[model samples]
Target: MKLSLVIPCYNESANLPLLLDRCMALDSGSDIEVILVDNGSTDKSLEVLSKLLPRYSNCRTVRVETNQGYGFGILSGLRAARGDIMGWTHADMQTDPQDARKGLELFDRHGDGIFVKGRRYGRPIMDVVFTVGMSAFETLLLARSMWDINAQPTMFSRRFFETWQSPPHDFSLDLYAYYQAKIHGLKVHRFPVRFGERAHGVSHWNVNWAAKWKFIRRTVDFSLQLKKSMMVVNI
Candidate 1:
């Protein structure tokens, strides 16, 4: 089966080369395609991608003229992808690009009608604590296994994706996909992967505690809205 993976870029100009290099190093046979998304980067990212993408035959670019949300960029790529299986990772390079291939390997064990995501390791102690806290909170609030809800290499079959109804257009897209998988009775798989530091540039959200708090508050609001919507559908 063909697999397509989207990497959403948002002003990640510096990281693009290494990210593309890591991706190109993978065996880019006809069965694999990489979709590099320009998510309204103000940096020279689009220019860089224009120059670099031609080097990889199996890679292509999708441009979003304005920066929306992370999910928006991913969704744009997903809508444009041409693969039997589709998923996404980040541009920050915190997780290796090979994780997509690893995630797709789950199809060997569980078949195509399953969802796979990374279970991150090797994060800083505080980050781990924060992730655990958030996971626990989401589990209690949303009543599902919400661990690693934002983890990369979240792969699922194209058939499963067509089932998405009103998927959110923000970071909550991960939560939306997770809950949708559970609600629709898809087999959920998680693989342990090493999480490393960013290859370049600072985080847009992790700039400071205030930024983190804003992210948390926005997520909570999204969670509440998602909970209400799921209840409405009896999902």
Candidate 2:
């Protein structure tokens, strides 16, 4: 089965060449296509992509003229994907884009009735603690054991994706997809992946406590709404 991996780029101009190099190894094969999304980047990202994309046959670009949220960019790529198996990873190069290959293997062995994600290692102690705290909160609050909620290379079959009713259009999209997999009884598979430093540019969030608090506030609000929706579904 063909696999499509979407990497959403938002002003990731410096990271593009390195990211594409890493992707070149995976995208060389026709079975795996890499979709590099220019998610309304104000920098020279589109120009860089234009010059670079033609060199790789298995990779292509999708342009979103207006920068929407992270999830909107991913959704844009996903909607344009041509693979039977589809998923997304980060463009920051913090998480290796090649890791998606392992996710593809999970589908090859387990079949399409599963959801696959990475479990990050090699993060700083505070980041790990933060992740653990958030994991606990989401698990307890949503009644689903959601760990490493924002880890990269989240993969599933197109059929599983088609079942999504209204996936979020922000970072919470990670939580939304993971929770959906749990509630839908998809066999969850986890693989270890190294979480490294960004190749370039500061994070849009996660810069400091204030940024993290905003992320948390947004996530908690979405989680509550998701919980209420689940309750309604049960009713």
Candidate 3:
């Protein structure tokens, strides 16, 4: 099946060259195309991508004129994707973009009735603790087992994506998509992927305890909203 990988680059100028190189490695076959979304970057990211993207036969871009939330950028790329299988990873290069290939293998095995995500490894201990805490909270709050809510390379069939309604336009999109997969009864698959440092810039979030707290608050709000929607649906 054709696969489109949407990577959102927000002011990721320094990492573009190397990121594109790594993406080139994924383009060795015809079934994959990478959509690098220019998420309203104020840096040289757009210029660098303009010059570099053409060199990679399997890559293109969608421009979001203003910097929106993380999920907004991803949704932009998803809307432009031309693949039967679609998903997204980060531009920070914290995880190998090639890991999506592993996700693709799962789809090849199980067909479109599956939702795939990366289970990150090699992260800092505090991050792991944080992930576990959040996962537990979401699982209880949403009444569904939600592990690794923010994992990379979240892949699914276009049919699954088309079912998404009123998906969040922030980092909470990860949780939204994961929860949707569970609620829809799609088989969930997780693969281990090594998480590492960014190749260039620091994270927009995940920088400090304060940022983590903010993220937690927003996610909790979104989770509650999701639960309310579920209740309405069941009514």
Candidate 4:
């Protein structure tokens, strides 16, 4: 099966080269395409990508003039993907691309399921606090159990996107996608994977009280909307 690796980047020029190299080493056993979605970076990220394009036959870059949110960059790559299996990772190299080989093996063995999400390890204190707070809030709001909903190395079948409705355009998009998949009776498996801190650029997340409140509000609204939609269909 053709495989596509989508890397969503924003001002991640420092880590792009290493990320590309790691990805190119995956044992996909089929044609592999690496799609780099540049999310309106002001740095020399685009130029760096241009230089690397000639080095790899399957590497391509898609540039967005405006700074769309993280989810938008992922959506852009998904739209342009030409592979049977679709996977995505952060451009910061926090998650190793080599883990992708294991993901592919799981997919091959399990046939088609919902998605394979990586469970993070060795998160910083701030990251732990944010993740715990968000997970608790989402659990309370959605009445569902989840682990690592914000994990980076997420892999799924390309068919998942064919019927996926528009997700939120913010950091919570990952949570939204998880809930939507569950609502559709899709199976989601969590795989233990290694996680490292960002190799270069600083994070863009806000871990304050305001961010917490906003997350709570969005989770409740989206959960209720999904429940209402299901009821309407049942009626």
Per-model TM against the reference: 0.96, 0.98, 0.98, 0.87
Q: Candidate 1: list runs displaced more than 4 Å.
A: none
Candidate 2 residue lDDT tens string, 101-127: 889889889999999999999999989
Clashing pairs in 4: none
Minimal lDDT window, size 10, model 1: 23-32
Question: In model 2, what lDDT does residue 129 have?
Answer: 93
Cα distance off (Å), candidate 4, residue 166: 2.1
> Between the candidate structures 1 and 2, which one is better when assessed by lDDT?
2
* Local lDDT at 217 for model 4: 78
Candidate 1 per-residue C-alpha lDDT over 212-235 given as tens digits, one digit per residue, 9 for 90 to 100: 788789889989997898789885
Candidate with better TM-score, 1 vs 3: 3
Error of 2 at 172 (Å): 0.3
What's the lDDT of the predicted structure labeled candidate 4?
0.77
Over 1-235, each residue of candidate 3 has an lDDT whose tens digit, in order, gives 3999999989999999998899899976789999999999999988898898879999999999998899999999999989999999999999999999999999899998899999999999999999999999998998899998899989999999999998888999999999999999999999999999999879999999999999999999998998898899999
| lDDT of the candidates, in the order given | 0.88, 0.93, 0.93, 0.77
Runs in model 4 deviating more than 4 A are 27-29, 206-235
Error of 2 at 196 (Å): 0.6
- The local lDDT score (0 to 100) that residue 214 gets in candidate 4 is 79
Q: Under the 3 Å rule for N, CA and C atoms, how many clashes does model 1 have?
A: 0
How many pairs in model 3 have backbone atoms within 3 A of each other, for residues 3 or more apart or on separate chains, i.e. clashes?
A: 0
Q: Which ten residues in a row have the lowest lDDT in candidate 3?
A: 21-30
Question: Candidate 3, which segments miss by more than 4 Å at Cα?
Answer: none
Order of candidates by lDDT, top first?
2, 3, 1, 4
